[model samples]
Target: MSLYTTTLLILDPDPYNSIDRLYRRVIQQAMHVTLPTGCLDIFVARPPTRFRETHFVVAQLYKISAELKQLENKEDIDVRVLLEGVGGFDIGDARNRSWEVVAVGKSDSKLLPVFIAEQHSSWFSPALQIIILPMERSIETSSRLPSLPSDEDGSHPPTEEGPHLGEAGLVIDSTDEEGGDLDDEGEEAQYPIVALGGTFDHLHDGHKILLTMAGFLTGESLIIGVTGEALLQNKKYKEYLEPFPQRCAAVLNFLAYIYPALHATTDEINDVYGQSVTIEAIDALVISGETRQGAKLVNQERTRRGFHALKVWEIGVVNGDANDQWAGKLSSTDLRKREFEKGELAKGQGTQQKLE
Candidate 1:
């Protein structure tokens, strides 16, 4: 099977809310639609800052990967997430970056880079482009490429020229025509105040996804419960754990970046329930699949305390690749273990050099 590395360019005005649907489309394109043969590398490029955080975007990619494993029954496609920096939104800049990412060494190859975008534009040189329309359109896959004008007799004529290769290689273009259309969709089902509790240690991509989802579900404010040090005493690699203040700062930094308008507050919690069980203002609770039972327990406590049971929203666990030395769901424990092993290896090398 031939492997094709394709970079998908998306103009996501608001990823925190649209990521779920965007990811679904990516999976559909790779599995049920085009490029089902070889290994497909889907690098999703989105504009940065106002509504999207790089970390959050990567987390969504991980979620997509996990879903693909279940839906496709294998890891044939590798999904990577890339962020278009502050000033890289221009069509030319995006084309340059996409080519740089996939064009590692095929300088003399005849393969023209495939460019997929929502609308057809002359800005892209037709002689140097292979444009694929968005998946939602009903056009045939072959019809997506720009076709030469037919003869007046309505018969298709063969042209001397083939598809022109773009200067930067393959380019895929896509637009977010649905942007802001679904913004209020989450509003109708909004929770005025949402609460989520976690150790948030090291704040990996998984944590960012959880935080981004929580922020998107919220309408007015969000309360993050950072686990206190006392609760992490029994955790593995406790010595390497980040301090509570640092963890809180990292969480807030991400929340602020993706949700600048959201009102956020962080507090220390020694217990699993935190203020969720007692806080009447909190309308919902966000948790990961692993901690879902904990959310139920918090609800139980709330019921006992005469408070309304908080709505529970669970995000799936971001699984790690089996190819990884430490294969399992992403967690702080796995990260710390990797770091510890690297340190030990360094020390062993130092000792061996000294003895020699």
Candidate 2:
């Protein structure tokens, strides 16, 4: 039924007269829901002879909803409450924190009490109609098993950690005017959806480790975003690095055999700059929390451009190259600098599988 209609029915007089005593009124509103953790009492508005009684019930209801959701680990707990009077419910107390929705209507102050139940049930109407009834609570599973094997020295297994199948994603890095082909210039992305990014001027075992991770992450597609040469060089040495397309081609060749996504975009990735790319959508952006700042910047830009905020997931970093690779050793810029010349550029193929 429409919410307005339901509100009217709910506001109707109680089937049994309950004006004489407070005990009778309290019993009338004691609806309960059974959950795995405990039983939650749903409150219907009780006519309070005094204002203090109204305050007491409000405190009790908040405690109940908070306890229930805490057990479920659910963030989106909507509180469709009926306040005792208009302006009775405080927005601060009922917001995204413990509640996602609150539909309040007429009462003492044009407000009703909090929602009586969390679930709706289906029912039959007197006019020979199917009336869906509402419910309060239910028991549910909290944990699930992983899909991919965590062991090493095994064929790549599909994992939800990296990319999701058929999730549309895009990657953009400015390209020079090559071959003078407009269609070939800047195009939408394609899939096994590999997104190879970061400073490629020093593509080391860390890069390879990430490449291996991507192969497992996106089984059918990949997009290599070379982040313009200016952008990369600007990162450290303060100069344009690979001049864009060359970096793309280098990453492409190293990854071409394992990657299925053939397209790439420029700084315009995530539609912030406007040009669009085609390919599997990116379900998650896997990175070490080191890039947390950059990721947050990108996400903020996405929101400003009226796009969905990204669901960025952070992964732990593997140590040196040996660890980064199936060899299980540390491999990173710092380690590379300690061994080889600092800032020296290198490139090679990434592993085809996650190591032991």
Q: lDDT per prediction?
A: 0.54, 0.31
Error of 2 at 279 (Å): 10
Note the clash tally of each candidate. 9, 58
Query: How do all models score by TM-score?
Result: 0.53, 0.32
List runs of model 1 lying over 4 Å from the truth: 1-9, 12-60, 63-188, 320-327
- Candidate topping lDDT: 1
Residue 10 Cα positional deviation in candidate 2, in Å, after optimal superposition: 68
Ten-residue region with minimum lDDT total, candidate 1 = 163-172
- Tell me the tens digit of each residue's lDDT in model 2 across 1-356: 12111111122112121111212222122211122232222323442322112222332333334444545553133322233222222222222122212222122212222322111211321111112223222222232222223236322333433221111111111221221111111222222333434555444434543443343344354444545434433243334243455545555554442233323332323222212123225433434324544555554555566654433433334321213342432233343344344323322222323331
